[model samples]
Target chain A: MNRDRRQLVLMLMPYLVGLVVLVLLPAAATMAMAFTETDLIATSRFLGAANFVELTTDPAVQAAVGNSLSYLMFSVPLRLVIAVGLALLLHRRARGSGTARAAVLLPGAVPELAYGLMWLWLLNPIQGPVNQFLLLGGEGGRTALGTLPPQWLTDPEDARAGIVLMSLFTIGETFVIVLTARLALPPEAYELAELEGARAGQVLRRVTLPLLAPVLAVLVLRDTLMSLQASFVPTLVVTNGGPPPYATTYLSLVLYQDAFEYLRYGYAAAVAALMLGLTAVAVLIQWRLLRRWASHGIVGAGAQRPGN
Target chain B: MSWHDPGRRRRAYGAVAVTALFGSPLLLLLAGSLREPGQPPVVAPPLIPEDPGFAAYHQAITHGDLVRAAANSMIVAAVGVPLSLLVASLAGFALTQLPRRLASAVIGLSVLAMMVPATALLLPRFVLFRTLHLTDTLVPLIAPALIATSPLYPLIYYLAFRAIPADSYDLCRLADLTPMQTWRRMALPQVQPVTAGLAALTFALTWSNLLDPLVYLYDRATFTLPLALRALAAMDPHNQPVFLAGAVLTTLPTLLVIGVAQRRFMHSYGPEGAP
Candidate 1:
């Protein structure tokens, strides 16, 4: 290497070491410990896929996987759609637009613990503004239209929906990224749509959505990966994994409780391994779905542009 | 809003409505915190307390050890964010300067590391820190600074630095500046927006990080703001007002910093998207 290249390497050394020590080594340990039985105190003995075998039959693990996937099913796509919608709606200059942007970011700015606590208060069955709004014109915990209030704490499906609802408002980061991307689009494209006298719905469906597809695809994958672990604090705080039968148990919470609470470090390592596997599967599924869409969307958008 | 046509008029309505919907939670937080401590969740309690007071905030501050926790959090953010920014910028600038084969390898490793689920690191990192006898100290909490809080940061920096016109690099080389010098004097200033954004993000992440402190901190004095709030949340269910006060205290600093920084870097993406 040349002298200058060596200097650059020197600068890279610290972060590289940090990556190896903090992330990679622990990752490898998780892989290795998945086959062992230890609790950070005992000498681990290799049990050779026994943890995996147990994991296959572990009902808690299965429920957690289901809960996590169900959350992703609802949250990831909804967050993206709402983020895109908010970006499109408020990205343009208007009165209260700046505050509107901050409002979207507000929930996300709060710490996870605080945010979870806020949701805990907000999802309170009787006094929460959510239920209060629902119960406006009626009494007995029923809405004006007589629908039952969502029991965010006790009911299994309602707990799941509550978690999903909590996840919805924190689309701030996604909203910002989408807003930036929205504002950055070549205005000429919009001008062309205007010259073509395209209606708002058509312009949105064709021009905006297709053009934003690439960024949205990347965000979808990112959000998918994050949502796998994002429910840890909220689930722990709000529902504490449910009214019964582990309704809202997520992988991160499961992993934490197993390792820390139950002192099953090795088993938790197994759970961690399970989480990694699920993440891979989730990403693969999303890639398959979005890869087809991104390519087609981009090509279609380009063709729809005036020059093309 | 008053002058623009139907589109702007509609946008104004939408903006106001969205703000109301999105902003209600925080508003509720303020209202709830103003209530008397230990008030039960009554069906149809007034949205604004009839007799709002500072009692909850006072109880939260005195009872929750929040002042101490806030100081610890400030310390962590102070130490962690700059270190993270430095490590990330250096590594990112280095990536842009490294030979192509080496750069690609490093970039690939970063992405792979970034892809590893954070939960998977919990047990092993805990054990690692325990083995080093660093578990109870604030060091493990700040150790994430070494990774720039997230592996993605360096790559973000790399993208920003690489966007600088090649002639800037050429100019540096013509001046015979060392890579570090060029990175410090040239590359750094050019990517101010990225740096500002990343700093806000890093500080927020470091400040709000609960997982690390949850695993590592046992002592109340050592707890960061989020962990302290978690402790406060464990109180009697009726004491909701105190915890809400705690939440508000926890969120204020992060909100102000990001709010201030967002106006600077977030609104403009210069040159690329102009009409």
Candidate 2:
């Protein structure tokens, strides 16, 4: 038993060392530095709560937080809807299903920088295909095509929309997860529903959806957490956080700029803390919501007694 | 299952529509890369370039120094992916053998660790690396992989290892195999699919990573492919074709990996069942 314990610790040593040096140490340092003022070159001085206080009133930081929240609000639901929708559509084995599934997964495999760049080109106002297609009505109508295409990267509104659209294609991971969950659903419930002469929509509402609710809830929480950080990349690559006014600047961008660009490590740490707190709150709220959902017996009752 | 069902037909159409809408950007990218340079740029470049050639690709590679940056990315992946897998898997396996209470605590800590976003760690990690004099080198970029900085991979490995029956360990004891030997002979073989999945996932992630490389490496020589692509984008913003070519080059290897391991990748996400 002792030998086994020793061996286990030996095996775990590398990760334990890593956990301390890499994750815990940095996290501790970040928490500590959140209360002090330092620029790495200068002598550090404690500034308790000043950073957080400034964050409350700072216009740029406020704009960034707002932008991030808007992104989370819009992107998470859109991504989940698209993911679940695609998973349902592709879960069955039908003609062309395999090819369609591969196409959906392709974007997720592309590098983020590459993916952002591709969107940058596609959304370009003057010479992009998206605008061109919008312009050419192709016998349906020529009326709306005459108007100028939206300046996706330049205009602030379109830029945010562009980011959201870019996000939709990378639903490969969520799609696979939801697909697995959907596929794992018992077929007996569906057959029973069919025997009762239930329509497809009724079956979906009464049986399929309730069964997949847990997975969908988890996906929502996961996507929400991811949206907070993942928005940083596209904003950085595509918009550089802006066409002035810092329109696309997100909280992650703010933290990055504060630390790396402005050399205000202390302020950045505080911002980082806030971002972490926000994520924790979001996750906790989702957990509570899931628990409440469970308590209501929406999922468990349906799962245990399907199609009653 | 029901070919004659109208709902199935609608779903099939919906699937095709989603694919077309989502897949058009990539098709456009491919077409744009093949467009002839110096053609008077139009309002919406043609889907099929009138005079297609390899000129844009040639220009991107030569001017962007893509070869060097790609080499740097290769170095990072070659070292980082395996190290991450080994460390995470070892930690995962160890968690199974430790007392249940300690294992849960460790698992909880790792889960909490995972919750801390990478952005939150960026500034402090930068400071830590600066203090260690490891900034501007590839070391900072590669070092995170050693610990499997994100707990997701380790958790995956833990769940995979946990699915193995406890009787395997008893059998190892009956055979007088050391725990290490037991892991090698029994557990490792059983978890090959998980290992492959994790390794591929790690490789693709490391290969595509831009933020870490951007924060850590400053010099052109140390730049990864993503950074190199960013540099190329900045240098020639007007030349969309060249930019697309560079983007294509950056995307190819990852696409190839996914295409080859596509089945295994999907299987990895399937329901975990006891063996």
Candidate 3:
């Protein structure tokens, strides 16, 4: 028994060491630095709550927080909807479904910088195909109205939309999860719905959607947390956080800029702390919402109960 | 569900449409990169370049330092992916052996670690590494894999191990195999597909990682492909063909990996009929 214990400890030692050096200690330092003032080059001085107080009034920080929230508000739901829609579309073994799935997954496999760069080119106002297709009708002829293409990266709202659109393409992982969930539904339930003369839409609305709610809830929470962090790369690479006015600057980018660009490590740490709190709050809210839904028999509860 | 079966022909057409719509950007990237460099910009870029050549590809490789940055990315992925897989799998196996409460606590902490936005760790990690004089080196970039900092990989490994039947371990014990030996001989063989999938995912993650390398490495020689691509984008915004070429080059390895491991990737998520 002792030998087994020793072997187990030996096996776990690398991870334990890593946990201490990489996660626990750094996280502690980040928390401590949140309450101090330092430029990274200079000696640090403790300033209780000073960074947080300033963050409340800082215009850039405010804009960043707002932008990040807006990004999440738009991107998360759009991504989930697209993911679920595609999963439903490709759930069956239709001809060429394998190829279709691969196409959907391809963008996600691309590096972030490359993906952003591709979007940057595709959304170019003048010569991009997206605009070109919009200008020309489906028959490859110009539209009668001569509509002008929107400047995607230059305009703030359009830039935000572009980021959201870029996000929509990377739904491969979520698509897989939802697809698996859809496939896991007991076939007998569908057969029973059919035997009762239920229509396809009715079956979906009653059975499929309810069965999927639990997975959807989890996916939403994961996407929300990811949106808070993942937006940084595309915004940085594609929009560089703006055509001025810092339109696309997200909280992660703000934290990054504060630490690396401006060298204000303390202020960045405070921003990081706030970002962490926001993530925790988001998770908690989702947990509560899921519990309510589950109790109301809108999700997993329905999965346990038989057909009405 | 039967009532909504759009006819087979229509479903096929719809699938084609979806693929085309989703694939156009990458297709455009490929087409744009082949365009002759000096050609005047068109009002709407053509699906195929009028005069395609290897000039942009040549310029991207020769002028952009793409080869060097790609080497750096390869070095990172090559070292990081295997190290992460080994560490995560071992940690996961050990967790499975721990008492129930301790295992749950460790798993909970791991989940919490996953929830923490990676951006939050940048400054403190930088401070720690700088104090250790490890900044500007690849050590900071690779060190996190030692603990599987993302937590997801270890969780995946744990789930994979959990799927093994208890009788298999009992049989191994009856054969006089120690736990370590049993893991090496029994569990490792059963989880080959998971290992392959995890290795591919880890490779893709490390190769495409931008923020960590951007924050840690200062030297141009040590820049990863993404950082190099960023520099290329900034240096000449009008040189679209060159930029596209660099993007294509950077994405090729990941695309290939995904295409090759596509089957194993699907299986790693869940069992054949289970989510």
lDDT of 1 by residue, B1-275 (tens): 11225777788889888889888999998898899987656766888999999899999988888999999998888888999999999999999888789989988898788778887898888888888889878899889989989989999999889889999999989999999889989999988878888998898899889889999999888988998888887865568889999889998999899988887686555224324
Tens digits of per-residue lDDT for model 3 on B229-255? 888888888888988999999999998
The runs of at least 3 residues in candidate 2 whose Cα sits more than 4 Å from the true structure, single-residue gaps closed, are A138-148, A301-308, B1-4, B38-40, B267-275
Q: Which runs in model 1 stand beyond 4 Å of their true positions?
A: A294-308, B1-5, B269-275
Q: Which residue pairs in model 3 clash with each other?
A: none
Docking class of 3: medium
TM-score, chain B only, every model? 0.94, 0.90, 0.91
Cα error of candidate 2 at position A36, Å: 1.4
TM-score winner between candidates 1 and 3: 1
Worst 10 residues of 3 chain A by lDDT: A138-147
2 or 3: which has the higher TM-score?
3
Off by over 4 Å in 3: A138-147, A302-308, B1-7, B38-40, B267-275
The TM-score of the first chain in every model comes to: 0.94, 0.93, 0.93
Residue A191 lDDT (model 3) = 81
Cα lDDT tens digits for candidate 3, A121-164: 88988787777777865333444365555678899888888888
Give TM per candidate. Answer: 0.95, 0.93, 0.94
